[model samples]
Target chain A: MKQSTKYMMSDGLAFSEKRDLKRLQKKSKEGWHLFSFLPMGYNLQKGEPKELQYSVDYRHLQDGEDQEYFELFEMAGWNHVCSEVGIHFFVAPMGTQPIYTDVESQIDKVQRLSKNVYMTAVFFVLMTVVSYFVSELTTGIVSSIFHYILLASEVFTIPCLMMVASLLYRKWVKKS
Target chain B: MKSLEQLTDSVFYIMAALVQPKHGYAVMALVEKETGGEFTIGPATLYTIIKKLLNENLIFLHDESNPRRKVYALTEKGHHILVKDIERRKTMLSLAERELRGGNAE
Candidate 1:
């Protein structure tokens, strides 16, 4: 069945096969396909029909089916909203999907960044508080819980920082 | 047959919508609602037109006190464009009218 994913706009930073291909090409004009494992099934096997219609239009397809998305935005006071839908349209020859970021995409990105940052900071501070207080109370069970929380937070800090870096690179470094 | 510069369909619709307070989506909605689907501007195009309108000072965003979506109404300059385009369209229609048997009905 043909399908379209409805990921929240905030979930944009996750790299797709399309994005990976573009990154490779940009890094080296003569980039090797190396290990092409893109998910749109863009590749061909012996005698398969040549690839077609791989490139995605980030713009709404304008078919009647999509009229509802157009309709919802019609509500008053929400006029400047750009549709948060971008697609990984595959192109033939050297099939590649360039990252196409628009305002809605950017908004999703900022929201994701802000939320992730806040969540991480909260988690870390909570652990720090627990670590300091649990030992003072001399309650073994509570103190163990605090240590575990601290360890979990230490594990989380790395991923969140990396995520923050990726978000920055996606927004600023690439745009610049 | 016409460059983007010459196409006034959107410009006219926007001006008409903005005669009263209408924002980006409202302009699109108003154009469609009023035109009965005869014309509908896509969101991308509508937002772009709004940016242009703001740049041209033909419309302004809502003040913070409004606590509502940004609505754009025409300025004197925008009104001039709307009027001119209306006349141009009317003149074109008149030419078509002259071709018919009951010519000059108006």
Candidate 2:
């Protein structure tokens, strides 16, 4: 047992509040809520781990096959992280770890990507309008057909420009 | 002295414990004992440190211990790091003393 020490951005619950899987299983025999954090770890080895490695089924988590668990993991941080999960779960806070996951930032990044597209659309609209009016004024000519043609041209060019912009944006904002 | 950042502190502490050839459990006990019940590392924390140390070859798992238990022994690089860290601390203490005494001299 140790005195109160500040845990750095990590689970402090392991002190008194947590139990190892072995202990948890033992407690389950006596009927204590066997809360688990991370998976049971095996002793690691050198040169490509052979057996006794934790497998993460990325497909199940990524795909909507495990929808309920996915939502819970999303709203909270982890899946299979037991608390008062069976019946008294109604009273306890629905979420577990309050810490932000990479997914949270990933969602934000997606929003930013959409925002980039919207901004690009607005910019192209403004640019097209400016170009049409300026070209008309510069040559002192009035052609509604040309205005329509210019707008149609933008339909193709704008998408191409947006694609180029997206590539550039991705390069600039590649997740470090 | 500058307070060592959390990451650096953990690294330093784990490296310090690996000065002798000791297994995972033994290192944990030694660190806990050294800190006088001030600290107890979680399994995950210890695992990460062990992984990093092993990857860097600053510490290697010795085969002398029970095959089940991962015993660690420090390398030449690890000794250099420990020595460098001690020297830096000494320099920092002297600088601190000078600054503290210098303030009163004026």
Candidate 3:
């Protein structure tokens, strides 16, 4: 028999991880278990209806660290679901201890994510600025090419800056 | 996590468990058991704290024969820091206890 699957659009984790996790939990109750991550969403496969709690952790595992890192979670009652980029998803029975129990370490997790987002935002901002300058200082085709580049960069820059702003606000809220 | 002059509760608990040379899971189990479930450290937090302690030279890998379940123990520095934190906690506890008891006596 063919399997049933569906795609759920994410609101961009930088903006809505908690909402995504809650949605995942709700989907699990409806027999749609998260199968894997999509570029901008989740691929869920229909399965047994089970109530579960989902948690996400961000870590850049080094060589030879995956085994130990995963084993620890498994032993602690969280079963690994799927990982994409540095984001790991896990599911356990409801009321399982959260992946982060302390504010200091939770802040560390946010900072790690913030660092990556900040870098991307800065890169796009630079690209936008450079292209703007080139487009202004040149003429004809070269200027037009830079103008297009400038437009693309600006397109990326807006969302990236918004993400960066949210991240900064998150860090500030956590610190205070 | 950055090395802080003061150990957070999670760090302090993990370090206390490492005084016996336990693996990551063991530390979690021990803390949960000892605290009667009053305190627990999640796996990611445990792993992060373990890495931070190792970086600060507060903990040392005691055994890695299994690779996947490497054991850790408190270093001399870790022991010293834990001892100091215990003293600090004791002071806090005694002050609260004395005040509470005096109020009750009244």
Candidate 4:
């Protein structure tokens, strides 16, 4: 099969899922359909143009219930697409019923996604601190190759913290 | 004896739609028809609500024979909550009407 793939970066956070959905829909209209989801992005295959409505659900599939969950959504008029970790993607024709029907459920989905991201951010921060202490104890306070690696890790931690902070602000500070 | 705290429009309509056993797409169709195009329940919302309702025993799977399309029906508990909610709304509407008439008399 002749196929072309497009890699687009995405924030694996709940708040940004809607943006990703919109992007997928737009790409689909241009004959680029989503083939699979990749880490931090999506892989789309070039194909006949489609006007498909895209939505992503953030839910952890339980043991032995994966088929049931997909069947339920499929029965609801959504065609299941690829899923990555806790994120499930689906598409239906334009005007197909939306997956979320109420504000409470929608908020619940947001909270779940935020919780996952928040926990990951916390874990990263703890790892960075612990590694810094261990490196200091073994390699002395003097700068070395290990010190440079630690510096790079600390820089990466900034974005994780920022992502958590933004999610918190939206969850609590923003009324909506 | 489940007391609902302000059912969202979608939840209310969905429950009402499933007074009879219906599949997922049927519920969506009924909701849209009943609302007269005023509202439509999204698939994501419907899926989540159905799962929650099933967990709370407000709704149950009516049939599992159809692998792709599972049918659902309201449980007894769901009926009780819906009727009570209707009665509550009736009371509120009657009281509002009485207040409006009293002001008119003045």
DockQ of each candidate relative to the true complex: 0.05, 0.01, 0.77, 0.46
**Runs of candidate 1 exceeding 4 Å displacement:** A1-176, B1-7, B62-68, B102-106
The whole-model lDDT of each prediction reads 0.49, 0.46, 0.91, 0.77
Q: Which of the two candidates, 1 or 2, achieves a greater lDDT against the reference? A: 1
Which ten contiguous residues of candidate 4 chain A have the minimum total lDDT? A140-149
lDDT of 3 by residue, B15-106 (tens): 98888899999999999999999999999999889888989999998988887899999999999999999999999999899888874554
Clashing pairs in 2: none
Rank order (by lDDT, best first): 3, 4, 1, 2
Worst 10 residues of 2 chain B by lDDT: B1-10
Per residue, candidate 4 scores C-alpha lDDT tens digits across B1-106 of 1214666667788888888999777887787787796898776677777787888888999997865567899999999988987887888899899888884554
What are the per-model C-alpha RMSD values against the true structure?
15.3, 17.7, 2.0, 3.9
Return the DockQ of model 2. 0.01
C-alpha lDDT of candidate 1 relative to the true structure: 0.49
TM-score of 2: 0.38
Candidate that beats the other on TM-score, 1 or 3, i.e. the better one: 3
For each candidate in turn, the TM-score is 0.39, 0.38, 0.95, 0.79
Q: Write the per-residue lDDT of candidate 3 for residues A3-64, one digit (tens) a residue.
A: 69999999988888899999999999999999799759999999999999899999999887
